[model samples]
Target: MSAYDAVLARQSWSKLTQEAPTREELLPLVAAAGRVADHSSLQPWRLIELRGDDRLRLGAAIAEANGDLKPSSKPLRASLLIAVVVSFRPSEKVPRWEQEAVASGVAHVLSLLLDEAGWGVIWRTGGHTRTAAVAAAHGLTENEELLGWLYVGGKPDGKRPGRRKPVDAESLLTRLPSAEGIAG
Candidate 1:
């Protein structure tokens, strides 16, 4: 599919099968997604793959962070969870926020690539993401911040594509006024 078509067809899939892309299948898509625009080439992002017992551990951590007696089932919703982390790099030229944006771009691009590859995917985030317990679960370092996780699995059998409302492109896009208008 063309880039435009792939993007237009992309949708978040909350219901997915237990099948997920293996490491060999996912690495190529991730490599492609890593080509996102980065100022100073500061690859300020990394992904952590979680499956089986790893997901259970994350669920327990999430439960502890939320002060809940029962572990959260959120992590088990998908066959795989890719934790998106923003690894801040010291740079006088690029601000921390810009680096965060670059990391976010990687996650978004990865989601698109996964969708195009016939994998069901959804980006999940919550208030507990920044909690100490959650961070420890992902083995995040002091310089890294958790953005979220991309939950991925196989598209369900005979599931129809999701319908999204048409975007109002004209309303969202506008040209800046000319110098004459600004002066006037």
Candidate 2:
């Protein structure tokens, strides 16, 4: 499929099966994601593929982090879960926030590719995102952050439509003082 088609057709798939992305497949996906707009080539992030026992450890961490909710409830559902991590290395040229944005951009593109490849993808983040134990499990230092959990699996034969609305072009664009600006 074309790149545009992949971008447009990509959807957040939550209800997925046990089949997941293989290590070989994931390497290419991560490479594509690393091609995102990272300012100054800081390369300020990393990703950890969590599966099998790692997923169990993550689920336990989640359950411990959240008292009321059962972490085991939905943690091990996927055959592979990629933990999208953002690292801050004290850059004078790039702000820490922007580095985080680059990581998110990579995650977005990776999700799109996974969807196009027939694997259901879900980007998840919660209280565990900011927890110290979870952060340490993935070797994220104090300046680093856990952006999200990218869950991958086989798409169910029948799935619900994604929650999306058509973009209001007029509301999204304005006549900025630029040569390519679209007048209001």
**Clash counts for all predictions:** 0, 0
lDDT of 2 at 90: 74
Best-fitting candidate, measured by lDDT? 1
TM-score of 1: 0.94
Model 2 alpha-carbon drift over 4 Å, by segment: 68-71, 177-184
Q: Model 2 over residues 2-27: C-alpha lDDT tens digits?
A: 99888777777778889988899888
Root-mean-square deviation (CA) per prediction = 1.7, 3.6
Global lDDT of each model?
Answer: 0.94, 0.83
- Cα shift from native, residue 164, model 2 (Å): 1.7
TM-score of each: 0.94, 0.88
